[model samples]
Target: MQIKALALALLGAASMAGAQETASTAMPDDMPPPPMAAMLRPPRPDSARPPEPPRENIAAPSRAVALIAAEAALAQCARDAHEVGVAVSDAGGHLLLGMTMDGARPGRIYSGSRKNAAAVAFAMPTSAVQARLQQGDAAMAARVKPWMVVFPGAVPLMAGDRLVGAIGVSGATAQQDEVCAAAGAAAVKGRL
Candidate 1:
């Protein structure tokens, strides 16, 4: 009737531009994954597996097992009549070996080297150094009494991280200076 209504208005404007170009090429069923900067990190720890040994650097327990445990702890403190003093030190404690036994007390060279240097500088075992010299704490009982030997025979020679020194047995009772410093750290347990 008017060019048949202008050909049905150009076929309903070309089917509404082909249904808006097929809904702009679709794709949206909830969508979400894709961003922690695109994900992938996990690999870092091998700068050459080799570097760890210092249990106090160990070792200082030798000096020919400090002269066979200061001659078997001064031959069992001369079988009880007691007169002793023995020493050995190195892992920074100094002295190598020192003796006295034959009726000690040449003024106990200052109480047997300050009680075996306060028992090898307090590595423990001299009855907690007589309960820290009975709690007066004279400056930490004088730090094993001048460089440690705290009686009951000073010890701790170890071998690995290498301390390799310290054994002190002083004249009798500290339980016979720990049985002659445990017979000089058990005659050097096969070189620790």
Candidate 2:
């Protein structure tokens, strides 16, 4: 039994060695490596690749501008006797500034952020998005991502024909929240 085991081990080793030798000899030394071969290959024709979407030079609001927007929204909510959270997001839906008023619910901050993201995604106010959803627009409803909020509390910040950022407010009635967000956008209108 010991002899048989030893013989099998030797046979396996011999087969592996033979396979390795065969593989090595299959490719010439002058041939480039796999990665280099890919690099050397010509690019696929334009028709073979999907057309890329047009690129736009969109700008994002600066930190100072974002802060101004958030402060303005918060102040508007306060003036309406509402303690709310404010969130300012860049065009790419990244938080640029965030603020929560005293006595506001902690979840209001998250709500504000989600509203901002939704506004940016739809390139319009969350109120419009909510209206569309209510009208049973299936196409628009399908575009609502999990991380987005279609509530009426966010407004996009546009600089001329370009979108720069968005502001969102939460903790008040939907209309009140949208009013606060519009105030925020107005505050930084010239700067954005």
Candidate 3:
């Protein structure tokens, strides 16, 4: 019995060794390495790019405009005796500026970011988002998404009919937050 067991163990060892060799050599033996030029080629020329239908140009708000809007929101919040946090984002939902008052709660910072995201996502005021959410369960279901704040604390920063960006305020009552955000949006209106 011992002799039979020893023979089985040896066979198993031989099988494992064969498996390791096969695994190690399988790829390199079956295929050549990729050419260096293929791996490190420059980007395709513009003409080589896939043809796409022409689309209207998009104009995102500048950093300077975002800063002006954020500052205006914070100033309005302060004037209303509301210590608040503010965030501004460009049309592409890129954060341009963020500010927080000395006494503002830490959560307000996150709330402000969410409000900004919500405004840019919907391309409208967050108050309108709130109204849409209240319209029906399906609207609320479709509207309540991750990282969204469907509340009254943000408004689009519009330059004429185009949505340039958005400004959001938090750390106050919903009405007060809306007031601050509106003030911020007003500051950047018609400035393009």
Q: Count the backbone clashes (under 3 Å) in each candidate.
A: 27, 0, 0
- Per-candidate RMSD, Å: 29.6, 16.1, 14.9
For each candidate, what TM-score against the reference? 0.28, 0.69, 0.66
If the candidates were sorted by their lDDT against the true structure, best first, what order would they fall in? 2, 3, 1
Residue runs of model 2 more than 4 Å from their true location after superposition: 1-58
Q: Residues 1-192, candidate 1: write the lDDT tens digits.
A: 788556666665565566455543322121233222222224336784466655354345555667776777677667766787777665555566777866587644334444544454555446567677887878766543323334455555556444455566665667777676666666775765
1 or 3, greater by TM-score: 3
lDDT of each: 0.57, 0.83, 0.76
Q: Which stretches of candidate 3 lie over 4 Å from their true place?
A: 1-58, 137-140
Clashes of 1: 27
Clashing pairs for predicted structure model 3, backbone only: none
Candidate 3 has its poorest 10 consecutive residues by lDDT at 25-34
| Tens digits of per-residue lDDT for model 3, 1-192 | 799667666666666666566564232123333333333447788999889868545456677877788788888988889999998876755566888999998877668767877888788888888887777658546755565777899898888778877888999998799999999888878676
What lDDT is obtained when candidate 3 is compared to the true structure?
Answer: 0.76
Worst 10 residues of 2 by lDDT: 24-33
> Model 2: number of clashes?
0
Clashing pairs in 2: none
